[model samples]
Target: MDRQTEFVLRAVEDRNVKFIRLWFTDVLGFLKSVAIAPAELEGAFSEGIGFDGSAIEGYARVYEADMIAHPDPTTFQLLPWRTKAGTARMFCDITMPDGSPAMADPRHVLKRALKKAADKGFTFYTHPEIEFFLLRADAPWNAPEPLDSGGYFDHTTLDEGTDFRRDAITMLEQMGISVEFSHHEGAPGQHEIDLRYADALSMADNIMTFKVVLKEVAVGQGIRASFLPKPFTEHPGSGMHTHVSLFEGDQNAFYDATDEVRLSKIGKHFIAGLLAHSHEITAVTNQWVNSYKRLAWGGEAPSYVCWGRNNRSALVRVPLFKPDKASSARVEYRAIDSACNPYLAYALLLNAGLDGIDKEMPLPPEAEDDVWSLTDRERSSMGIDTLPRNLENAIAVMEESELVAETLGEHVFDYFLRNKRAEFDEYRRQVTPQELETLLPRL
Candidate 1:
């Protein structure tokens, strides 16, 4: 047996594991799993577990429904909250009955993007500042109410959600997920957890697992966790501000000690490409109807396409360089929300940066002032472009994007557009409470 397989099997036996969960994500980025008893481990590791692809959103048509999920042994980990005597989980790669990688799989989309980066001698690393809210457990799914009045970095005495975060972080650590920091956010009942950087693929898997664990911990504590982009309008929305860096072997490709900004030409070009294509990818990066609400009503959620040093107002910002820590030099994309499909989001960011590198795009000037507050004349003079205002416009922008289409593959690209269109229609047809309150009496 290979080392990975041997390790997983031995761990299962030694730990007295009774059940193994084979985890995979559907195209919409929802976690889907099937549990297997101990007797089924060998066959699963060898031949994989089968499921009906037709039932999954954007997965397969009725005619060609057969699919398989090959468990990745390296991802084996015990669910710390569950009984050790037989519950473990591992991520899986979706494949066709014939063993080909499923094109519709979000994981495969990311793998293809990673391969493209590999061909150019680059490795992608990402660290995400994932933010979410702890809400009243009794609240309806459609409308979540806050659990506390805590604001940014409040003490446990003031931040009622503190113990919940501590518990969640402990459980995450036990599951082998390394968290860099956790604290209350700017909004009441909202929190942020920063995960240490890892390779793009491993980080995506961690993000998926992180969401599951966060919800599980919240429910156990008699609270509900939400990653929705804009659950509240009066308060700041939860965003997944992401830090991105490129590596060429052991060296940080983005760093240049001699440059005034300390960003290499490659780094500058990468940011330029990201800025150039930022509009096209928002439909994927900010994929929900409510996501545009966060973007349009900015609360540290960037909508302008510009980059700067130490400027959070810009869409991308070059973080302050740490002396002797070359790897810390990276660009932070601020527009992405915690609710996005991590695999697709990472893919677009990498590919967009690569495109800029290939084109040798020149970096634009920094926008140090608040872009949101800038007058139209001033913004136009600065050559800064705003992101799409709504999901309909975002979908339309994505429809015309060659980069997004190629990155997602035809299966996902087409399905995503169709699905989003339906969502827009459903949303537009609704008579919102706000409309009823404001318009009925006046009209």
Candidate 2:
């Protein structure tokens, strides 16, 4: 056995990790888990546990039913809250019965995209500022109770949820995850915790852990924590505004201190590619009907397809660089919501950015003035395009995009469209409370 596998085995025994949960996610980012006894873990590490892929959404069809979950030893960590039997967890990589990668697996999607970057002598790194809301357990979806009436960077008396957040950071630290900073967001009860930048794959794994840790902490405190894109209509929606950059060997490929935006040629190309394909990738970034509510909000949510330096309104921004921190010289994509699957989201992002580099796309003029204020005609004249306003619209754009299909692979492309179309159809049939209130009396 490898050293990492042996270490995990030893840790499980020493920590009394009785129920080891194997974790993975569907294409839509919903967490899935299965537990195995400690005795079976060694066999699982050597030979993966088998499951029916046809049963999983966006997985294989009935003809290709068999799949395997190979647990990644490096991800093994004890669930600090699961003291009943001292449970542990590890994320898995899904593969076919024959041991080939399952194309529909989101992790595999990212690995494929990363291979493209690797081929080009580059590696992608990401740091996400994940924002979420803490609401009272009984609070309605549209009317959530704020744990704190605090604004951006507000520091007030510690509430139950505040204690939960503190415990969450502590638990995350214990799991070998480094948190850069944590603070209250602009909206009441909303907060953001930024993770230190790491390779794209590792960052994706961290995101999964982060969500579970947040929920575990909240459950312990008796308040519900939500990562919903726009849980409340009046307040700012939660965003996973992620900063990304590329590296060539040990040097930051995105940094060129002399350029106008202090961006290297590769960085400019990457930005151009992302902006050019932003609309194409929007379906993956903001993947739900509720996600549109956040994207259309204009202030923090980026609606216009433009780039700027230190501008929050633009979809892409070159964050102000600090001297002596070359590693921090990167661009932030403000369009993505917390609802997205990080694995697939990162895959599409890397694919889009790499496409720009391969094509040597030129960066467009910066939109210093707010692009959201412009008329439709004005935006069109400036070559600024808006993202799809709804899931239906986004899916239609995705269905037509050759690049999206190529990046996501055929298995995922077909399955995702079918699932989303069904969701939109169900949404179409539902009569919301607003419809009942307005149409019942008037129509």
TM-score of 1: 0.98
What lDDT tens digits, residue by residue, belong to model 2 across residues 13-110?
99888899999989888888999999999999999999888888788779988999999998998888887888988999999878899997998999
On the 0 to 100 scale, the lDDT of residue 123 in model 2 is: 94
Task: List per-candidate RMSD values in Å.
Answer: 1.2, 1.5
Give per-residue CA lDDT, model 1, range 1-443, as digits (tens).
69999999989999999889999887778889899997899999899999899999999999999999999999999998786465999999999999999999999999999999999999999999999988998889777789998888887673449888888899889988899999999998899999999999999999999999999998888898999988997998989999999999999999998888889999999999999999999999999999988887764889899998878888999989583468798999999998889999999999999999999999999888988889889999999999999999999999999999999999999999999999999999999999999999999
**How many pairs of residues collide in each model?**
3, 0
Clash count, predicted structure 1: 3
- For all candidates in order, the CA lDDT equals 0.92, 0.89
Model 2 weakest 10-residue run by lDDT: 320-329
Model 1: lDDT equals 0.92
